[model samples]
Target: MIRPKLELADIFRAHGPAWRQANAGHVSLGQLKVMSAIEACRTETLGGHVAGCASCGHHHIAYNSCKNRHCPKCQGPAARDWMAARAEDLLPVEYFHVVVTLPAEIAQVAFWNKKAVYDLLFRASAETVMTIAADPRRMGAQVGMTSVLHTWGSALTHHPHIHMIVPGGGLSPDGTRWVPCRPGFFLHVRVLSRLFRRLFIEGLLALHRAGALSFFGDLAGLAEAGAFAAWLAPLRKSEWVVYAKPPFGGPEAVLAYLSRYTHRVAISNSRLVSADDATVAFRWKDYRIKRGDRQRIMRLATGEFIRRFLLHVLPDGFHRIRHYGLLASAGRKANIGKIRALLGQSPAIAPPEAGAEPVPLTLREPCPCCGGPMRVIEIFRRGQKPQSRAPPRDQAA
Candidate 1:
């Protein structure tokens, strides 16, 4: 019997008329490729290639995987490998998680200028951290931080935010000593929030001046410079929602966090409860409540679920994971070396893991009458195949 997970895959495998209707005018090349890849994943559509069984002499025609980054089936291994590479970059110090969110008013703008707005979110958040940490009145040191962009809320709604995992301390400007933040506090959330709003608005204005942002449909009126400026005016006056939780209890806690938050898409397969007929059910966390007790399960029509998931596909080739301050990619190694020397901490080295390839999967057995594991046994490949089998299975028996 197919498990629910496999059932979900089966659903993804079919390019249902419903999916076509929902995405009729909205499909992009990337989405089309993703759907096609999922449909052809284990089927013969793309033309199956052979993978001979070492033991059974079975010439199994293994179908090829699409290997697209956005495919849910393919992202797990990709995320694992990426996390492994980043494991070596962990600092042996306390770290904090900070979230910078755009108000709904700005989210409308962000929806249209995702790449540009997201980039600004990263830059603005990083700058806020670095500036405050380096202030003599504050931490008085230079900090290293990593940021990841998340574009969706728990219910797969369009909510743009930046999540940053930052070391809780930094090196002094003179590079003479390590400076630690107040035990329970990093930067002032209110101050950071204000600055973030300013920086983001400034970047938005720049993009508008550069003719890079678009306003369409409901946002058509925002195309006017005065309208946009007026729209941004209120956000600057109100709190911009910079949230900071306490530092991760330790370095290990930080790693556990990155594993959960970074590289995550709008939803994970495990969250899916079921997909039957034309409805899909899934679980999500309602973060508005206290942290540990906020999970909820919800259901949506299959078309709506797919639409929500695809809303976060991201602009092509956009980098969602970003490094800032000392962790910035340009000179991260050298900076890490400098910081390690100052803090008297050695460079991080990932512990060795028992490297092993996973066992390949195969069907339990061939249909009893067919004997042994199923195989193409013979190939009339594609158009060359005989019009029909000599006899159907029931008739053959």
Candidate 2:
């Protein structure tokens, strides 16, 4: 067996409280809850159970996981559950990965108004894709997309962007047949960049008019209409960043990519190099650098590291994953069925029964000594030790 490396929980357990006390005024309730949850995740504070091997009689204690979306240790099971539900939605076609990123100016405002700005980001990107695809000169189909919101960059900075997994084709406007895109191409990035910019800026202006946006710190003056319009002036001429990667090899590749991005938090435990009382070190990628020099180490004071991690807590109940166009949940089942029928393919997978419990992927690892299944023979309450079971008379001798 291999031991796990350093984790985010370790850093939180060591420095969370001190950082919270120093920045109590700046931190939100949601951020504080996330910090507390990460600090106590999988520890005795949460609870645990005891599992024993029936063949070898070997037993070990296992702690409960926090199950918080922000917890690094909890995302594996969450991603698996999400994937199970999404398996039925796969189409028999190539998929494209498109990214829409906000300029630094907008990102600065989005830092304080996360919910509003992030919602605008999703709306603008989805509209751009669907609108362009529907044009008769373009793909001339109604595409479906799964868009995920990511608020942090590789260095854990507040760089807001959208990651969209889009099928390479769509249903005809009349729903009579499947419409496929060009073999390996999806959309023109330049066109998407222009439309996304117009839509996003227009939405931002509307939000400002409705008094739904707030400006503060260095951007406080933007509350005035003149200042806000002036702030957006340069953005109109500057090209927005919209990138589209080549089509995925197949459906399996799309699932593999979604598993990584769907539930990712600011940073994963594997990137953490070390943490101490005064400072922490971690690996980060600098995309601007050459490929071989991209990987680099970043060290920051413990408090600052914690602060940067908390920068992405998100407003409570704000969804980071969303679907649009044909993939929208309202009628996704019917839409998928129609598409499959048109393509002369059978259903990819059956949907789960109405009230069935999700089947566990694996109950437990095999016993190390006997290679037999392990069973949870007893459950121990928090702070309680497992009671020892007496041995058989022959074995006692």
Candidate 2 lDDT, 1-397, residue by residue in tens: 3324678998898788788788879888898899888888777687666666778787666667888888888897899879878887999899999999999989999998999999999999999999999999999999999999999998889999999999999999998989999999999999999999999999999999999999888899999999999989999999999999999999889898999999999998889999999989999998998657789899999998998999999898999999999999998989999999999989776666776743332244676668777677666677766674532211222
- Top lDDT model: 2
List the pairs of residues colliding in candidate 1. Answer: none
TM-score of decoy 2:
0.93
Structural similarity to truth (TM-score) of each candidate: 0.80, 0.93
- Candidate 1 TM-score, C-alpha based: 0.80
Deviation of model 1 at 265, angstroms: 1.3
lDDT of 1 at 173: 91
Which residue runs of candidate 2 sit more than 4 Å off their true CA positions? 1-3, 351-371, 382-385, 388-397
RMSD of each: 6.6, 4.2
**Shift in Å, residue 162, candidate 2:** 0.5
lDDT of 1 at 7: 34
lDDT of each: 0.73, 0.87
